[model samples]
Target: MKVVLAYSGGLDTTVLLTWLQEKYNAEVICYCSNVGQEEELDGLEEKALKHGAVKCYVDDVQDEFAAEYIYPMMQANAIYEGTYLLGTSIARPLIAKRMIDIANAEGAEAICHGATGKGNDQVRFELTAYALKPDIKVIAPWRMPEDFPFEGRMDMVKYLEERGVPTTVSAAKPYSMDRNMLHISFEGGILEDPWNEPDEDMWCMTKPLSQAADEAEYVEISFEKGIPVAVNGEKLGAAALLKKLNALGCEHAVGRIDIVENRFTGMKDRGVYETPGGTILQAAHRALESICMDREVMHLRDSFIPKYAELVYNGFWFAPEREMLQAAIVQSQETVTGDVRVKLYKGGVHVCGRKSPYSLYSPELVSFDEAGGYDQSDATGFIKLNALRLRVLATMKKES
Candidate 1:
């Protein structure tokens, strides 16, 4: 048999790379998708080749990920469980889709991933694969009930050493990390305890809140129809703009979240995320939308946000409802063009200023000293008319 595997050049994937070849007597083709992980990806092909992959295909889909996946979620404000931005969740389908395409291109009979049965990724990867190609075979070795044994991380490590495969992580500090342009997610190992504060040394992207400068830094972000267009009046493409903001926000220790979230597989999991640029962008976008979006329509759209967030978190990026909800979300953003200035200091974001061509804020009407409408007497009748229901309820209570 010939197989295509989603290989990350990590310990689990490296072990699986050799295991799949041995078990099925198969030719393995590796596929890697880069969704803004800034680490060196140059040596991945060589690593896969060393572990017996027949061929490796690597694609830098960061732009597509940001434009197609991240932006749509951002427009919807799809925060899963009211916190997570679905950083790791949103990237899976794109990777799985490309893996399927490569499988077809290479004439591979089966596609495999290294996601364990205990995690949400297995569902995300398999669901997308099956939805995209119903006839395609999935090889989930982790879910196998048969005799082959490797119960723990240490077991896997020993197995890799026995085979002479290069492994980076060991038993001592065994946290698994996944990174993309949106954020970096930390899981497993010592992070198992929900009460434990993540060590400051573990954070790779953002500065510590304490180490960050005491003075606040202000940034102005511009949005066009809910999509961030420019920063500080500088025009940049989608990828460049986000990268620029990530740099600035990381310097200020802007986005650091440590939460214990319920996984799709019916267990609570701890994930620490650092989403510097996304934090600033989400906050600024919200301040802009406050004036731009209509009251009731925005309320109705907000109701579906949790469900939309769940779909992205659970890995249904290509599902029809996500597309449908996204259509409504994009429609709500029709008038969502504006500029917002935010102050970042230590770990907090403060909205310092906001403006737009379509702003509903009227200085003349709102100014305490203006008295522009000259309607002091009109409020008496308006107040009485609005109070009619309350008066009746009060009279009924008094009589009773």
Candidate 2:
């Protein structure tokens, strides 16, 4: 049998590579997707080959990931559970799709993942795998009924050490981390206790508030049809633009959140995330929409924010309903072209100024000094007409 495994060079996956080969007597082909998990990919392919992988593929999909997956989710301003940016949720589908593609190209019969049974990623990976290729076999060791030997990180570490395999994980710091271009998520270990605060040293992207820059920094972002095209007046590709914003946001301590969220499996999990670029993008995008988007249209799109966010969070990125919502959301961004200036200071992203060629804001009409149109007395009739239903209800109560 031939198998394609999603290899991350992490503890679970490193052990999984050897186990799959031993247990199933299969030829394991390792594939790693480079979605901006910087420095983590160093010597990844060599490590996989040194183990039991018959072959290894390290594909750079960062630009495609930013333009295709991350940008579309931003169009909906999707926020899961009203706080999380859905950073980790949004990256799974793309990774899974690429895995399936590799499997087909390599003539593999099965694709495997390191996602555990208790987490949301297992569902995300399998759903996308089945959705793309219904007949494709999936092997999840953690979900197997007592077939996998290792119980936790410590056990996995011991197994690797006994076999003379070097691993990054240790008994002292056993928490897991998942990183992509959008964000980095940290969970497990001490984070399992909702009351425990994450160690300051564990943070990889953003600076702590106290250690952040003393002076506030202002940044201007240009948007074309709701997609960011430039930062500080310089044009860039989707990936470059996001990277630029991430640097700025990090300098000012922009995005970091810790929450106990309800997972799709009906269990609550605690997760900590750092999303520097995405945080700035969300604020700037809303600011541009404020002027360019119509009140009614914006309201209608806003109504779908929660649902759209929920769909993405629950790993329905390829579902018909999500695509349907995306169509409407994308249509609403027709005139969402503008520049928004934001002030970043001590973890706060605040929109300070916004301008758009399609702006509906009429300064003269809103001026306190003068009425843009000669219609001061027209308000009386408009107000009374709107109050007709309330007046009728009051009269009916008085008569009763």
Candidate 3:
């Protein structure tokens, strides 16, 4: 059988490449999606070829990922479980979609992934694949009931080492990491203990809070229809703009979070994430929305944040409901154009000032100098009308 594997050049995938040939006698075509993970891809093709891949395809989707996937999520302000930016969750669908495209192009009979059965990615990859192509076969070795050789990370490491394949992970430091343009996540291994704090050395993006820059730095971010368009008055493409902000965020040691979150698979998982650019973008986006979005409209859209985030986290990116939410989110952003100035200091991102051509904040009407309509007396009647229900409740209580 011929199959296409979603290859990451990681421990699991590298071991799986040879395992598929030996176990199922399958011809494996390796495909890696480049979403700005910052890994060295220079020798990836050669590495795959050396490991018995019939063909290896590396597609760069950074710009597309930033624009189509990341931007839309930012527009909705989607955050899973009130904290996670869904960095790993959000990137999976895009990767899975491209993997299907490769499967179709190569005329492969089955598609495989390195995601373990216990993780959320297994759901994300298979859901996207089944949604896109309902009849496509999926090969998940980790999910097999029996006859799978690898029992643990050590086994996989030994398998590769015995075969003369170089691996990045070792028994000395066994942890799981996933990265993309938006953020990097660290989990598993020593992080399994809820009370154990992550070592500072494990951090790949931001510095320690105490070691952050002493001086505060201000950045001006401009948005057009809720999408970040420029930084410091300099226009940049979607990927370039995010990269620029990531650099600035790194300098200030911004966007670091550690939390225990409920997974869709009925388990609590502890995750540590460093989302430098995403954190700044979220703050700036919300700041601009404060001035540009209508109060009622903003409140109504805000109500969708949790649901939208849950959908993304649960691997429903291609579902009709998510698309419906995206439609409403895009509509609400029609007038969300503005500029926001944010301060980065000691791992904190604070929006200090915001302005927009369509700002609803009427300074004159809110002034104490009796400017713009002189409506002080009107508030008394409005207040009394609003308080009528409370007065009746109080009267009933007093009589009782």
Deviation in Å, model 3, residue 29 alpha carbon: 1.3
Regions more than 4 Å wrong, model 1:
145-148, 157-174, 371-400
Pairs clashing within candidate 3: none
List TM-score per model, in order. 0.92, 0.95, 0.96
- Candidate 1 least-lDDT 10 residues: 144-153
lDDT of each: 0.88, 0.90, 0.91
lDDT string, candidate 3, 196-239, tens digits: 99997888888877778999999999999999999999999999
Candidate 1 per-residue lDDT, tens place, 1-400, comes to 8899998887778878888977998899999998899878898999899889999988999888888888878999889888898889989999999999998898888999878889999999988998888899999888874723778768878988888886888455658888999999999888998878888899977999878878889899999999999999997778788888888888899888999999999999999999989988899998998877888978998898999999988888788988899899999999999899999888788999999887776787778898877677898999999999999999999999
Q: Residue 185 of candidate 1: its Cα lDDT?
A: 94
For candidate 2, what is the TM-score?
A: 0.95
What stretches of model 2 exceed 4 Å from their correct place? 161-169, 172-174
Q: After best superposition, candidate 2 residue 355: deviation in angstroms?
A: 0.7
